[model samples]
Target chain A: MPLPKDETLIFFSKPDNALVKAICGRLIPGSPEDPGAVEAGAHQYIDHALAGYYHSQRTAYRRGLTAINAYSQSQYQKEFVELSNDQQDSVLTDMQKGTATGFESPKAPDFFNTLFQHVREGTFCDPAYHGNQNLVGWKMIGFDGAQVAHFDSHMQVGADQSERTPILTLADMEELNFPAPENGY
Target chain B: MSLPKVDVVIVGCGAAGGVMAKELSTNGMKVVALDRGDFLRTRDVAQLDELRWQTRGELQEPMIKDTQVRWRPDEKTDTIGLPFLMASGIGGSTRHYTTQHWRMLPHHFKQYSENVARYGASAIPVGTGLVDWPMTYEDLAPFYDKVDEEIGISGKAGNINGTIQAGGNPFEGPRSKEYPMPPLLQSTVSRLAKPVLESLGYNPFPGPSSIATENYKGRPACTYCSFCTSYYCFIGSKGSTNVTVLPVGISSGNLEIRPNVRVIKINKDSGGGETTGVSYIDATGKEQEQPASLVILSSYTYENIRLLLYSDINKNGMVGKYFMDHHYPFVWGYFDDTVTNPSTGPWAANVAIDNFNGDNFDHTGLGFIEGGVLEALGGDLQAIAGAGVGSWAVPMPDDTPSFGEGYKQALKKYFRRIASFISQVPSLPYDANYCDLDPVVKDQIGMPVLRITYNAYENEIKACAFMQNKAENILKEMGVAKMKKAGLFTPPTTTHEVGGVRMGTDPTKSVLNKYLQSWELPNLFVVGGAVFPTYFGYNPTHTIEALAYWSADYIKTQCKPGGSLTQYF
Candidate 1:
């Protein structure tokens, strides 16, 4: 098992890295106005997870990602990352619908689902886990992140109370002086 | 090697077994309880990480081949097995459970008789194994009250005695008193659903839970943390058995709960009619035996049934038949304005209506015999989970892509605005759906695992659709912009597993007697959801505890020195 260092590709090769970045960008694409999975470093999460918890899916990633690029070349005469946005989306639709050919082991739809689930996890998971970079994902979607206690006051919210009750995280609990659990989490 | 004799030996210290350990030992009976897992506390495994707890299953049981069950949709299909989600430690799944405390409706206890009297015998579905419980709601009523006060439940009283009480479940059977503590604070969904339901002539109230609203019985009050379902209580507010009964049992000095001791077999006498003691593999992996006058099997439903068959105690082949579980149906919608931050508060918090549950409604011409509890599922939705394409069995709406800018917009809409709903509809037992020893699969210990063959009966399928329709109606009434209806027959992750070794009046048809005692062996008692005569659309923990108290009372008085164990027989 390879461990990921900062900016290091532990599981993905240089070619597969570009493929992952391209796929994740399309999975939850956004502009600078509203950053999404790509801006949240979801591909980095996938790289980190594949090195550790999701090590079993390494072969599946290799096969499915390779199959996807191969299918892209067969259709558009270019690699997956080089396709136009419209063309890329069309290819992804065929993959999701399981209509795309040159896929085995994990069918096209299965691979799409797995990749989509991971991309979502990368965008929405806690900042400590490498995704949700700079808390941009939570900010974009207006989510309350990892709050332990939601008293009556917490429920009754006015306009964005980011100053008083900003979106908190597990990492913020210590420095922000949130009450530690009696069980010492 | 055989150890010294004890008065009783109980196996698998879980929801039912923990109660036995508390009740019998307090009554001066020397008891030894063996558990295959550790006695974990909140301090041992407290975290708020969804990836660790809910996704990766940090607190759930590992799928050991020995305890795994082979599952098939029906007998015609090949089996695919996953270890059912259950906790192994002393508190069992209760440690991480959402703590929805409930009592069975009066009709639920006598379903067969009630159905026949109300709709005639022809209304009964074919090949169904429905029966009236040997005991009535009246029999279990006092014990349910015991669970409320002793175990620390929080809710209003819908009805006290014959008088109807406000703010509680009016459909609940007559209770002796109100809940031990007041109900938890309402979520936005609970507040929103109240008047809409009342205007539509439905009673909406806070769901009864075992979490403390006030500082009851020395535990702190609940913190309204949304991480209640899969995560352990960081502060011991929730009434898990580890924090409640087992500690009290330990203080008495009459009970010994040995963890990491796997009870493999219930040793039988020469006649094979009575149990002598149990053989267990201790923590060091050394096999040992302990002699006892009485034996109680109080594990989870699966293990209680599996151990009986493994021990060859199925004298009449009634050991692992009539397997049953719940089939959950979900419906949800998105709001334009209301910010019901669903990622806060308790998992089962907020408003629920039991109007469609059990036989509460007239089944006449409805094409279904029973229904389920429909609730405002707003509070339990996690923000991170809402971002996923298909978390909580709810995928994006029809024709909506699960990716790109559209998917990103969908997540933002689903997060703060969605008010979800679901029903815990129960499946009935058919002769064809049952569990037996697997032919090909064996555990690491070379023990054949249990194989479960189950399929929803026509009645249950109809019930699932009925509940889904009801949920959709409630959502539509609440005035939602975009609605989504999940597919029917989504397998239940909230495993309210019940039935297998059923209790009945007839010895040939049941494994245990009315008191949950084995028919052939008077000294052997089996308890838990495994002995449920029929399934009800409610959580089974309170019922399991009530039965333990009832049987322990019998063992104390009637099965003691001057009394005969087989008096009922």
Candidate 2:
């Protein structure tokens, strides 16, 4: 009953998904060569998070996505995701600077901050929610992933150390090898 | 229905609650210890996974639907989802915290008096509510040793009875005992920092940690799992109460623990003017009243004050008055010439510099009365969420900026080559910064949840700026390239949450007395960091534990007799 998986995304529809991808592209822009939030399963993770750990997190996400769309219509007369990358950047920059207004918004500062925070969180959080797939985040940063201990050859320090003693380190997962570009989805 | 009565009703099972339970129960006084969270074992926690807890803040308090509160200048609850952060459940915040324990330096006790003597009182910040604790370091020293030994601290004692060590806190007051375990493994980052620190004439010591270096008592040694701060110890290795005290207390037969029982109020007998018992909601949503002769508010600082305020337990309504937290800021740099695996160790770093802590520095022209230590924490990249792996603090492919084709090159070149250092500064209590019931918001139980009011003082800001400079200097000495000093350090956070029901000699100015006795009702006691009259320049758990043991001894010896209130010892 405590929900099977860790994160279940709540408020995202198909359009909302496109908006999150666009916003995340701006926040933690992924190049074509390197897997970005979209390819890293950020959209899927967001969907799961809304359904999982924070169900109410969806309400805020919905409010934010709706506001971005409404603001886009008034500013550039286009949907948020449909705008040119530069145009989208301009809108985000305005929002970040607290210059944007209207759209039943809870102040531009809070809106931008909440939106930006969620996107970043969705993209960079543990891949268990479906984001950072194939250990994209772990491998890119040389994160070893969660291991039982630091008991590997790397942990062989000064003698008098025991063999059965575990050196479980969160930073040294054996499977967290850096991804080859060709192998990525 | 008739319920069993006991001598003391201690709420929570964390550092303070555990100490009170052990001390009071072992003293042969019957105790009914209640915790509003589930019981967690050390082995149960040691099985944590990053995908489950760490990145998601899962180990932290669950997000109460629309229960989040915020404090802007106007005291607003208008914002729908403001991050009103506070960890709840049995051990409260301590259950999922990195146990980086450090005893407060001697001068932290008498900050106001000493600073006023050294520098004019005018040097104190206008807005800050800084004050000297009613008790002194000497008063708390013996208890510090007792708690350190009982709970098991790990570090080399820098100063023992006037003898200074080659490394360790030379500024520390005389200690009667040594740590239970040796210091943890110093990482490559700390190794590189040593010569640079010595070259610059500053001593860097392996920080005092509750993480065991050797198997002590029943708990195992730290596995260096690197999932410390946000994750529970999967191996039962860390010195959290689940591993150290709770089990011991449970086996004693004198101690009775009831987890998942939410304390609604400290039920006071209106006629007798003494605390009769507490009314709590159990996990099954049934209300029950547990009676006791004495009550100790051992919950975290916020809950300790909030429960008292909600129950109106204190006569003068001084609960939730002096909320304080350590204002931590960061200064990070990128280094090119090293194999710095920033993410392959415990959450704690090895090097700590206490040179600027408390009144260690001359306050001649300084705006702040108190100062704080500057240190570096070695971090790891277990997930992409925390992955900023380059010279320019570049985020992962989708974690930060991937502007153009050139940006791709930047990520590959700099991801593993960069390391960062952070600064931890002391935060003093302030008059404008306090907590009270919000006029608008209410919790699930319909009690008005606490409303926090805080803004950084000029002195705190100045202190942060100073600590930043010191950290940058250390980074520079360590041969870091592009050591960027983070600017502004805006919107002081609620991480180190301290003082609310502040302890003082006068009942009018303080909620609890020097012995942690409530001024209105002598039988009632409030322990934990909430009773701290002033904020010291370190993590508050160690001091809170020492104070709990000290106060428990007083309760057993003198206070239980029902005699005069003015007696000391």
Candidate 3:
């Protein structure tokens, strides 16, 4: 019942945070109509994953962050979060089309593709590693928390699919606002 | 450095190594068994967690230490196929495997010749290095029974005394004995699908699992924690060599096991002719020399061949050739109607329908001789199994929200409404798809690891796609609301790597003879999966154990009560 590390926090400047919000909005966009990543808590969840549990993705993560920074610098002549929503959308589209400023670099295209994919994965993966904050992603995808088996009457054909319940969520824990150690080390 | 001389030097302590250690030691021969990994006791395994190992692949062969084999055209220049992936710790891959054992079907021995006669040689995939096994299924039957009895297999008899049964595999080779224990309990998932399977006319029998259902011999019954395959059983319920063989082997003082010793060379005479001993780098990187009258390469499939090729021993220079691995493509279904608990027990649930396994069905007209076993395994909920789901209910086609009121309701409705049906197809060896030495990329000790070069031929692809379709039909017949075939099938590579130093009658054609002895070097024997000429529909643990017993029995008769090494030469 303890809080995560401060380094794990992904509170970007308005410009950069706005860019992330825009990208995540396209990936899963909460409520389909509003299409916002904040509602999914995807940015916060991604920050947590970046700080921990995504060790295998370090190279891709670094490259991706660099690519986004370069795109904002070239296209808007400013940071990504500072750009307007339309401007952010244009930069992302250009990057995906392999025409962004640094996309010509040997590893730039790869870096951009990997970054967007990781962001999407982070937003949607299980909440065990701190992504999908507040069960937003799970609730969106209809996933229950680490259930043992669901092969019961739920697995039958034409059986009533209602009355199903998730195993548990972090919200269910009584000790929610737990304190964190200054340094686990 | 001081040199110690023993009668035999066994290269590993897993399934084959354990058996060789017991056989030679019990026969009054001094045996020195060396393992590259540490000795993990019950205490090491007793602390089980779903997070630390299962989801993280702590038990699997790593891409860093154990590289997967690659396929390339140029043999000398291309470094792609070298360094096949395999487990390195004590008990080797057996420590982490699911332990579903089955002998290669009877026709597997004569597959090449039989297929040629029926389907014609053109039907066989070109470049495939398929060959008749040097020995017949009948020859390995007694040994298989011995291994089954020793390991305490928990399977219901499929064919007792050569009589075909309705539920068991009708295509399995004759067995001298029955399984030591009864099969594990069937899950609710299996029960719900069984009736539909029968109505569709498929033979579903209890899958042969190594997990103990009841107290067998000295081992306890399975606790059904659902953390298997990648996790070791803490209760000694899983029939790994650590629990079944190594214990008894160690009790007899003749078996001297040295863990953390990485064998670097099969030390030959200065002339580089006959093997005299083995030189290994210990855990501290200190070199130690152990001399022996005989050496047994009982390592994993690729490791055994790698060690031999590094030593430059095979007279014909056919050290690494004919590597094979199975093609597994899963078929999954999401049921709109609920029936059973999705997660309940051990790794595999229910039984297998072996109608298409081996030559069970008509192969005379089919393009491929063997097919696969279509079945479902109870899903293990360890971290790897979660695989990113947020909603609990089926998403409406128009639904686009991931988080909000609609999303929460959806997440609550469909979390456990999924089931998977799978296919286990047979893989054959090919000429281009073989194991060989890589000139570059040496291991820590400067010895080249065995490189695997493999590509599934058209026949294999066809067989896999066919089996996948069959699996889909079975799922549909089971009345699943929505079923999807698991696709984007990548090539396979891992612990079950087989063939390379295949067994055959002619020394010019194979490395090992019928008795599992190197035709060129009679005193040196090779055990483990490398001797298998073809892959079966099931896991390789049981067959490897059977071969180990067969090799051990042969070694005891030919090399024991020793008069002289001159007779072998």
Candidate 4:
């Protein structure tokens, strides 16, 4: 599935956008055989969340992105997005260990923690939120998404029933004839 | 606008209020219950969206938009805004709870005396205000049976009238009879670990759950959909107040639930000895007064304390004292040979070993005053919430890379190969651990927000370490290929918070009397986990429900129109 084009950037600036894309590339990098956070529309998920549920972190992201660029310029004489993948990984490792310099209000480790959590959520959360596009993350992790799972025979110890069931999503529940509650909320 | 006076006006239609409404209204007394959030419908949670329900605060109250809770380790430190584990709707936190219903063991009620008898006087920690509950487990056993049957709990009774039974918690307090229904089907993790636990000389049984095993009381049985905790039961099998007692209360005709109405203050009589009514802001943004002959405070622990402190009804300043929570420690194991399909059963701990809980095991030389129950849980391995640091269901070992190719490979390999164990360590009440009204911050309704002053005591920290070691041993005995011990730390989050407005036989140290009625204000009653004297290793929902019923029975029998408060006093 393709990424949604209707999403407008709410929090990330031009430089921050490039930085986020680079970060997603290393955090959940895709190869010819596997899908990653970029393929799951993680950037779009963060972009849409900033306008609503995660609006409180807007200032922190702004400050953290600025510090990352400053650290990148000092170390590599280039912007964060302009660095090689190995260099970007090194910078992220420093931030993760809380040893990165040029961070002020929102600490470097705190920013990394928040960004990493959001990336995970974007990759694995249901597709209703515009993330997990086409359920790539679920497929990668072998999660049969949101089925009315009643496993009487497969619940025995040492049973490997993973291959028996097909993955289902919220959109497919109706066609699959999953039972809905009598009184709707 | 002013509402007509009723027999009783209850605040916060959650666990306690739901029970009180049903009991009082069924007994033909008029009741008006107020809740701050909307009475959510079944369709409001039709989709099992992990991001909205589990990862985000969909079922919980929004800290920024509704109330602000500040927390500080001690009195000398500055407080920061913290998110409390509570919900605001009509059914409250029970709507999203994992439904691990537990009755407090007999010793939990008389801990002060039992500890002294078992370990002598010095065993009682110095500053910990450990006291015996006003009522004993025997006195509340009938009520426990009532709630278990009424709410459709499923479990195997360990002991029935002094006879020990097999395949059950042998340490449990003796019940008058067996459970209303058989236990839920055991998960693969529990089934695999049963023989191992038995070989280690521990009793393992299916944990008591409020989730239905078979269709009873017009609700469907559990579907084992793996979306049990932190999400509404789409099948209406989990026994939340919304699906169980609240509907009965509403059908009684005498009970009126006013949703989206925030009670700001409780109005007192001119002499300040009794409550007359309560003032609230309705959903239309208008101030409304609801007058009643009796008032019951049945909100969550933090709010119950906040409401009492906000209204200045805590005559001796003891309302917000002695706050406690169960300090939780989790351990996970990865098995290469066993396919622990964790996503195919109820999300709660499916089986539990209670041999170490409460005072069942000898704590004579353990250096810790208490121990916790260890259990093998299932179906909580959600995609989004499990991808964080120290998450219980995350299968990544300590040495694994957090992200990239290695992380991807690890996720796929361990996703279905992991099983988790948790220990609910009991937290004792200390003078330093308490709740109070924030002096500076206010909620959206302009009322002073609740502030918590707490840190894990020596007993709790020691207990957590002890339980973690035990958990690791059990996982090793189960022959897991790789084991990971999630180290113990005191986080500000707890779903099982108890004891703010405590009950005691003596009025000097407690806010409520033996019957959960106010010591000073005889007509006022405070129900819920707020009346607990100390935290127990077990989940407090069953005890909370039982206490609510016990208090309602007292109100019904002793505090009638022509009855006198002398018997209670």
Candidate 5:
């Protein structure tokens, strides 16, 4: 249920769009044996949020992405997505520490915090929001999602309920006759 | 447009307003209660969407459409936007509250006199506007019992007529009887913490909750859905005003609830000595006048302050001074063997150790004058909320990576293994921590927003550190492998914000009288936590309800058909 290409391209340009994907991948880069933000469709989630819930932050994203590119070019003489993994991490580290130059208005640390929070939300939120595809994020964190009832037996002290049952989501709740939200507020 | 005059017109039909509407209408007084938000049906809360209700605050007043408040830690710094943690609809914050209803200890009401007597007058902090409440706990106890019975609060009474009871909060103020309902079932975290607290000789008891444990008043018991905090209960188990008081008020046939209207000002006489009615804008942007013989302001703390300031009703310049909130600090424990099951029960303090709260323990040499309650809580297991450092139950430690494979592994490992103890510390009022109209910000309707100037004082910070140490000790005694102390020095977070239009015996130092009546304007009665003289360790909802009932009774007897207000004064 990822956003269509036409809708995804509305929030960011092609180059900045690829840069978001690259940043999310580095923030939660999973191994070949495990799932991460990339597998959870965090980039698509960010795109969806930018077009809706986080629409007010569009200006900050644009300014922050441009400043990040400028800082990358000055440091590595290349675009952020084109840099090596280590180089990209270094540039992001600078931004996180608020030491990256050329960032104004939104500032570097503020932008980093915003992007970090969005990436986390995209990774962990219910898949009905078009993220957490296949419940990868939930599996990664051992979170048994959306148990409407029957948690008493599993939630006992010293109980190992982690491997007790199959995980559920908001989508499953709809099928199980449990009330789910019809629309976002 | 002009509406027909009623006997009483109450603005903001939430906790206090709900009680007022019920009492006045049932007593045969025609009442009109206006609320800015809709009276949501139970179906509206049937869905369990943590992302929508908890994280995004869908049930709360939207900052974009509502008045967005501003805040700065200190007066010298530039103010930043802060969310007013209040709900707007029929129930106000009571709709989405955790329902951790608690009656304030007797010592809380007499903090000023008690501290002065114990440690002498010079022990009082220089800038702290510490004062005894106009009324005592004894004066409000009957009303407290009334609210507990009417709202069906569940708890074991600790003190009954000065006799200490077993397996209950022994430090509690004397009560005539037990709670209306039994306490909610204990969670795994509470079970684990009980032995540890008892070993330390701290009296551990079940926290009083407004959520029903058994069928009461035709409403079903709590389902223990874990969506208890920050989300409405679909089963009508939580004793919110919408489910309990408002319905009774409407059933009386004398109460008229007008929703989706904003009261802009409390209209007064030409001489500005008494309130005549109120001017408001309807949902369709039409200005209307709702004239009444008596006007009661029962909105949240911020709104009560804002309306008073907006109406230019600060005759003694004490309209929005001494704003306070319980400066909450959390201590978390990571146990490898124990499954704390942080997402199980009513999502409130299930078990609390009251030995350290209020004046229960001596504050003799402790630099601070007040202390706070320590408790084991549950149901903050939402994923997105737990990902952040300061916002989570088991937050990422300083050494842990912000994200990556390591972060994912840590989250999985500690998801059910982490338990936290939150310290609900008492906050004394300070002259510097006050609220005024923001010069730069305005609401969606072009009204100036409230700007809060507050910071953690030395007393509060020291109390927080002391409580954190105590929490850490308890966690260690519980055999926690790893522990982290999180003492927050941020903006006012606890929803127990109090003391804006504070009540006092002296008119020069207060806005409301002992009966919560406006000193300058006799017909205007202000209710809610806004009239609290000081913030206590416990939640303010029960106290607020009791005060509202007390004020309603005062209005019932003193302002009835032949009763005279002059006689009371």
Candidate 6:
């Protein structure tokens, strides 16, 4: 369910998208054995969410991204994306602990928490939402996406099931469909 | 628009309303059941998208202005998080319920008397509004069986007409008949805990659930689809009233179900001694009057109290008093060697032990009066939650850092190897915990929203902690590598919302009578969990369904012309 790569950005600007990618990389670092948020295309997922289900968070994302960059500039005279891996962790820790400066409205902690939540959602959500690219999230952790029934074989699972078998989504099942105008955020 | 009058106008056609609708309509009385949501068919609930259904509380009562429920820890504090538990569909919360159908034990009906009889007069907690039920378990036992057949329950009866049956909850009240359907397959959680439970000399039987194991009344059997709770049944297997009694009421040709209709005012006679009917907003959003001889309020607990309070029917300032809810303390752990694959069966496919619940064990010197049923849970699988998306219930192993590589590695390790257990303990109704209208907040429809002032008390906290210890003991015996006991007792958040419009014999002390009939107005009846004076440790749906059938019989046989139904009548 990966979106076509050639498609234009729906919500994020090129710079914002790059910033989100860097943040996603730090939130969950990508690895060969177990791909994390960056490898799962969580930035794209957040962008798509900002365009649709989470349009209200647009200002928060904008200001929060700006604040992260501003704080990075102030602390190290560089953009957040240019920070070293260890430096990036320290910056994010400050943001998570509400210690990072110049963040308002969604303060440092609020922005960091919201960003982390969206990152997790993007990393682990159904690929029908256009995240979890190649079902890497489902594969890294053994989650059978959408099973019609759970038999004894499912309970006997020792390794990641998504790695061994095909993962099901809403598109795979004729019975399931997204009922929209999803309220109650 | 003025609609045609009916014999009964039932507000909130859900768990109790469905049964009442089926019963009264079948008895040849015309019934109109109005709800604020759609009559979603089985096909409407096919999807299991975790983000929408679980995290968003999609099937829950939508957080519109009119459907708002505000909460605070106490009267002085500001309202905190919005507590959304009830649903709006034809089946209400029954649609998304885990279907753990359990009949309250015999002693649960006599909470006050049993404690006094066993441990003298001081056993009852101070300021607790504990009282003996005006009606007995035997009185509702027949109706409980009727509910068993009506909703197609799957269970093994522990006690049948005073004789104890093997493999069933031995502490349960005597039942007149066996369940209509047999129990589902024991889950991996159940299988893992079965020998351990027996070694501890506890009776381990598969819990009773409305889910059918064999096709009955044309509903299919459960598929172990994992989307059982917090999601509706797509295949008509779960005995949601939409597939059960509600259809019977419709097919009987005497029931008229109006969805998306909000009942605003339970109309009363000018004298304030009789119910005329109800004034409501129709499906098209026009205010209308539907006059009837009787009005039944089955709109869950909060709204039931809200409507009565708004209608100025607070007889003893008791309409919104004595609100209570069940205390659910969850205990879970991660295993190193075993992959318990906690994601296979529905929640009902687990075993239940009543040795700790109700008056089964000695509560003589304990800090609490009553205990709860502790069960090793099964198939409480949520992909988003298990994957660590939602903050409500992220399944990271105990002591693992919540972020970075340690978080990812811990979640991956425990995703398939976790074991979870829970206990459902009933919180005693205290004088301080109650529901009233929110003066500051109003719904879009110009009605005052329900403001609940509740706090988890010592009795509930102690009971929950005790059960958490017991569950941890069982998990430790099962040999878990790492374990976590959830912080205990946050009230009015979890489901099992009961009380508020309590039933008692003394008209001065309670809102409704034993038969769920309004004490002041003979023609007005309030059904559902709102009438539970105090809930037992069991899930309240079984009792709610039983009371509906019990009241429906009274409405049919005695609550009519010339049978001393009421002096006014």
Candidate 3 chain B has its poorest 10 consecutive residues by lDDT at B389-398
Give model 2's TM-score for chain A to 2 decimal places.
0.70
Q: Give stretches of model 5 more than 4 Å off.
A: A1-15, A175-185, B389-394, B488-490, B565-569
Could you give candidate 3's per-residue lDDT for residues B446-550 as a string of tens digits?
666556666666666777888888777877776667665544243545456677888888788888887788876667889988887777777788878888888
DockQ of 3: 0.11
Best by DockQ: 4
TM-score for each prediction?
0.93, 0.84, 0.81, 0.94, 0.94, 0.94
Off by over 4 Å in 1: A1-5, A156-164, A174-185, B3-5, B63-66, B284-286, B389-393, B565-569
Which residue pairs in model 5 clash with each other? none
Better-scoring candidate (lDDT), 3 or 6: 6
B203-290, model 5: which lDDT tens digit per residue?
A: 9999998888878887677767676677877567778888788788888899998888999999888999888899998889899999
Off by over 4 Å in 4: A1-18, A56-59, A161-164, A176-185, B389-395, B565-569
In candidate 2, stretches whose alpha carbon ends up further than 4 angstroms from where it belongs are A1-33, A57-127, A151-185, B62-69, B73-84, B120-131, B316-318, B337-339, B384-418, B486-492, B559-569
lDDT string for model 3 (A3-44, tens) is 336324453433444556656665444554433345556666
lDDT of each candidate versus the true structure: 0.79, 0.67, 0.64, 0.81, 0.81, 0.82
Predicted candidate 1 versus true structure: per-residue lDDT over B1-569, tens digit per residue: 69998888999777788888889899887889888777776655545666666655565654342377678877888988664678777877778788888898998988888999999998888888889999999999988888887778998889899788888888999998888899888777767777888988999988989888988877778877677776677677787887888888887899998987888899998988778999998889899998888899998777788789999999889988888888877787777766767776886677889999988998999877877778787555554666753224345555466678887777666567767787888887778878888889888788788788888867888888888777777778887777877666644234687789999899999998899989978899998988997888887888988998888888878755668753421
Model 1: which docking level applies?
acceptable
Tens-place lDDT per residue, model 6, B1-569, is 56877788999988899899999999888889989888888766677677767756677745342577888888779995475756787888788888989998889999999888998887777888999888998899989989999888999999888899988888888888788888987777778888988998888888999988877777877777676777887577788887888877887899998888888888888898898899988878789999988898998888899999998888688888888887778888888867765556787888889899988999866878888788777675765677665424545765887578777887778887778888888888889889998988888877888988888888888899889888988989988888887778756767778899999999999989999999888889999998988878888898899999999898887756776543433
CAPRI band of model 3?
incorrect
RMSD of each: 3.2, 7.1, 6.7, 2.7, 3.3, 3.6
The residue-by-residue lDDT of candidate 4 on B1-569, one tens digit each, is 67888888999887888888889888888889998877886555666667777777577754336777898889999999876667888888788888888888998888889998999989988899998888888999999999998877899999999999988789889999999878888888888888888889888988999888877787777777777777777767777787788887777899888998888888888998888889998889899998888899998887888888988888787988998887778888888767787767776647899888989899988877867788997675667755552233365877679777788777777777787788888778898889998999987768889889988877888888888888888889988888787656555577788888989988889999878999878888999988998878888899999999998899888766567643322
> Best to worst by DockQ, what's the order?
4, 1, 6, 5, 2, 3
Q: Candidate 6's error at B497, in angstroms? A: 1.4
